[model samples]
Target: MKKLLSIKNIIISIAALLLVWEILFLCSSYSKALFPSPLMAFYALIEMIRSGTLLSNIGTSMYRFAAGYFSAVAAAVILGLILGRLPKVFQYINPVVQLLRPISPTAWMPFVVLLFGIGDIPAIVIIFIAAFFPVLLSTVSAVGNIDPIYLKVAKNFEISGSAATWKVIFPAVFPQIANGIHLALGTAWIFLVAGEMVGAQSGLGYQIIDARNNIRADILLATIFVIGVIGILLDSLLKSAEKRILKLWGLK
Candidate 1:
C-alpha cells in the first residue's frame, strides 16, 4: 500500500491527468490558443527554460520567500519567548496584534506597494505579515502552558534568575515553537505567490500572470505545477528539520 502511494503513484497520477487533458483538447473545438494540452504546456516550459526566464523567476520568488520567512522566525521566536515569560508585556502588545492579525496580507498589498514602491521589499514585507502571528501566538501559549512541576524542580536545583529561562523556559517552549514555525512556514510560502503577483516584473507569481495574459495555458499550467512542487518541497524540508531538532533535544 505504501508503494502504491509512493513517487510512482504521483507519476501515474500526472500521466493520467495528461491523458485526460489531451483527450479533452482533441475533442473540443476550442482554439489551441485558448486551451493547450499537457504536451503543449511541457513544451512551453522548455521554451521558458531556453529563454532563461524560468530560473530567474523561480530564483527571485525563492529569495523573497527566504527573506520574509527568516525574518518572521527570528522576530517571532524572540518575541514569543519574551511575551511567554512576561504575560504583562504580552498584554501590552495584545490589542495591537489582535487588530493586525485579522487584517489580510492581500489587503495590505496597496499600502505595501505604496510604501515599498513595486519591488521585492513589498512582497517580502507581505510574507512577514502572513507568517509572524501564528508563531508568536503559539509560542506565547506554549510558554504559559509549561508544566508547573518542572518550574518547581528548576527552583529546587537553584537555577533561578535569567538562567532559569534559558535552561527551562526555552526548552519547554520548543515543542510549541516547533509546531508554530512549521505552520508559519507553510502559510508564508502560500502567501509568496499572492504577495509577489502585485507588480513583480519577474518571479513565479509574475510568470503565472504573464502566462495568463498571453493566453498560454500550457505556460500557466507549468507555472502552477512549479509553484505547487516548490511549496511541497519547502513544507517537507521544514518538517524534516523540525523532527531533527526534536530528536536532538530528546523530545522525539
Candidate 2:
C-alpha cells in the first residue's frame, strides 16, 4: 500500500511540474535561447539520442563516477571501522583530517591537475576527495553512537575481537553508514561532473559545456535535464538499496 501510494504521488507530482513548466513557457515570451521550453528540451534530448551524444557522454561520466565512488567507499569503511574501534588512534589523526576536510574539493582541483595532468585521473581523484571525508566522518560518528547494549549483548555471547566487531557492531551501525554512503554518492556525482567540465573530451558535463560555447541553448538545457534525471535515478537506487538493507536488519 505504501509503495502504491508512493508511485501515485510521484506521477501526480510529475504531472503538476510539467503543467507548470508548460504554462511558464507559454506565458513568458522570452526568446527560446533564453529559456527553452520543456518541449524544446525534449526535442533536444531526442536529437542527442540520434547523434549518439547522450550514451557516450553518460557512459564516460559513469566510469569516472564508479572509479571515485567505489574507491571512496572502500577506503572510508576501512578507516571508519579502525577509528571507530580505536578511539586513541583516531584522536591522533582527527585534527589533521579535520583541517583537510574543511577544504573544498574544487579548491584542490588545481593541485590535483598539476599533480596528475588533465585526464580521468584528476577527475577520479577529485571525486574521491569530495566523497571520502563525508563517509569517513559519518562512519566514525555512527560507531560512536552505537548502543552500548549491543556491545554487551555480543560480550554475553562470548563474541570478541574481529568477529564481535563485524558480526555485532557493524550490522548495528548500518543505518548511519547508509546515510554517509548516500551523501557520498551525491557528492561524488557533483564533483565528477565538475571535474569533467574542467578538462574532458567526453562526458555529459563536457557536452553541456560545449553546447553552451556553441550557443546551443536547447542542447545545453537538455544536457542539464539529463544530469538532473541521472542524478535522481542514482540517488533513488542508493536509497532503495538502503531501504533493503534496513529491512534485512529489521531496522526499517
Candidate 3:
C-alpha cells in the first residue's frame, strides 16, 4: 500500500509539473524555439535516446561519478575513522577542513583543468573534492560521539585493535556516516555535471552546451529534465541501499 501510494504520488507530481510547464509555455510571449512546451521537450528526449546520445553521455557521466564518488568516500571515511579516534589530531585538522569546505568545486575548474587537462580526470577530481569533506567530517563526528557503552561491551568481549574498530566502532557510527554519504552523493552528482560542462567534451552537461550552441532549446530543456530525473533516481537508489544496509546491521 505504501509503495502504491508512493508511485501514485510520483505520477501526480510529474503530471502537475507538466501542467505547470504547459501553462507557462502558453502564457509566455517567447518563441517556441526559446521556451519549448513539455511535449516538444519530450519529443526531443525521444530523439536523443534514438540517436544513442543520451545513453552514451549517461554512461560516461556514470563512469566518472562512480570512480570519483566511491574513491572520495572511501578515502574520506578511512581518514575520518583514524582521525576520529584521535580527537586531539582532529581538532587541528578541522580548521583546515572548514576553510576549504565552503569553496565551490567549480571554482577549482581552471586549476583542475590546468593540472589534469580537459577530459574525465578533471571531472573526477572535482567530484572527489565535492564529496570528500562532507563524508570525512560526518564520519569523524560520528566516531567521536559513539556511545561509551558500545566500547565497554567491546572491551568486555576482549575485542581489540582492528577488530574492535571494525566490529564495534564502525557499525556503531555507520548511521551517522550514512548521513554524510547521502549528502555527498547529491553534492558529487551536481559537481559532476558542472565539471563536465567546463572540462569535458562529452556528457550530459556538455550536451546542454552543445544544444545551446545549436540553438536547440528543446534539446537543452530535454537534457536538463533528464539530468533532474537521473538525480532523483540516484537519490532514491541510495536511500534504498542505506535502508537495506541498516536493516542488515539491525541498526534501522
Candidate 4:
C-alpha cells in the first residue's frame, strides 16, 4: 500500500511538472525549436531510443560512474576505518582534507584532461575526487562518535584488531557512513555529467552539448530528463542496497 501510494504520488508530481512545462512553452515568445514543449521532448526521447544513441551513451556513463564511484568508496571506507582508530593521525590529516575538499571536482578537469587526455580516465578521476572526501570524513566521524560501550562489549568478547574493526566497529558506525554514501552518490553523479561534458567524447552530458550544437532543444531537454531519471534510479538502488546491508548486519 505504501509503495503504491509512493508510485501514485510520483506520477502525479511528474504530470504536474509536465503541465507547467507545457504552459510555459505555450506562453513563451520563443520558437518551438528554441523552447520545446514536453510532447516535443518526449518525441525526441523516442527518436534517440530508436537510434540506440541514448542507450549507448547511458552505458558509457554508467561504466565510468561504476568504475569511479565504487573504487573511491572502497578506498575511502578502508582509509576512514584506519583513520577512525587513530584520532591523532586524523587530526594531522584533517586539515589537508579540509583544504582540498572545498575545491570543485570540475575545477581539476583541465589538469585531469591534460594528463589523462579526452577519455574515460579524466571523468573517472573527477568522480573519484567528488566521492572520496564525503565517505572518508563521514566514516571517520562515525567511528569517532561510536558509543564507547560498543567497543567495551567487543573487548569483553575478546575481539580485537581486524575482527573488532570489521565485526563491531563497522556495523556500529554504518548508519552514519550510509549518510555520507548517499550524499556522495548525488555529488558524484552530478560531477560525472560535468566531467563528461568537459572530458569525454560521449555520455548523457555530451549529448546535451551535442544537442545544443545542432540546435535541438527537444533533444537537449530530453537528455536532461534522462539524467534526472537516472539519478533518481541510482539513489533508489543505493537506498535498497543500504537497507539490505543493514538487515544482514541486524542493524536495521
Listed per candidate, the RMSD to the true structure in angstroms reads: 2.1, 2.4, 1.3, 1.4
Give a tens-digit lDDT track for model 1, residues 1-252: 796679788899878988998899999999888888888888988999999899999899999999999999889888887888799888999999999999988899998888778889888988998999998999888988988986898899999867887888888779778888889888898888998788567789888888888788889888888888899899989888989988988978
For candidate 1, the C-alpha RMSD (Å) to the true structure equals 2.1
Residue-pair clashes per prediction, in order, are: 0, 0, 0, 0
Q: What TM value does model 4 have?
A: 0.95
Ranking by lDDT: 4, 3, 2, 1
Runs in model 1 lying further than 4 Å from the true structure: 1-5, 27-29, 158-162
lDDT of 2 by residue, 1-252 (tens): 999999999899988987898898889888878778888888989999998979988998899899999999989987897799888889998999999998888888888878888878878888999999999999998888899999899989999988987898888887889889999999888888888887566788788889888888889988987898899999999888899989998887
Lowest-scoring 10 consecutive residues by lDDT in candidate 2?
A: 196-205
lDDT values for all models? 0.87, 0.88, 0.95, 0.96
The global Cα lDDT (0 to 1) of model 2 is: 0.88
List TM-score per model, in order: 0.90, 0.88, 0.96, 0.95
Give residue 224's error in model 4 in angstroms: 0.6
Error of 3 at 33 (Å): 1.6
- In the predicted model 1, the residue pairs found to clash are none
Per residue, candidate 4 scores C-alpha lDDT tens digits across 1-252 of 999999999999999999999999999999999999999999999999999999999999999999999999999999999999999999999999999999999999999999989989999999999999999999999999999999999999999999999999998899889999999999999999999999999998889989999999999999999999999999999999999988977877
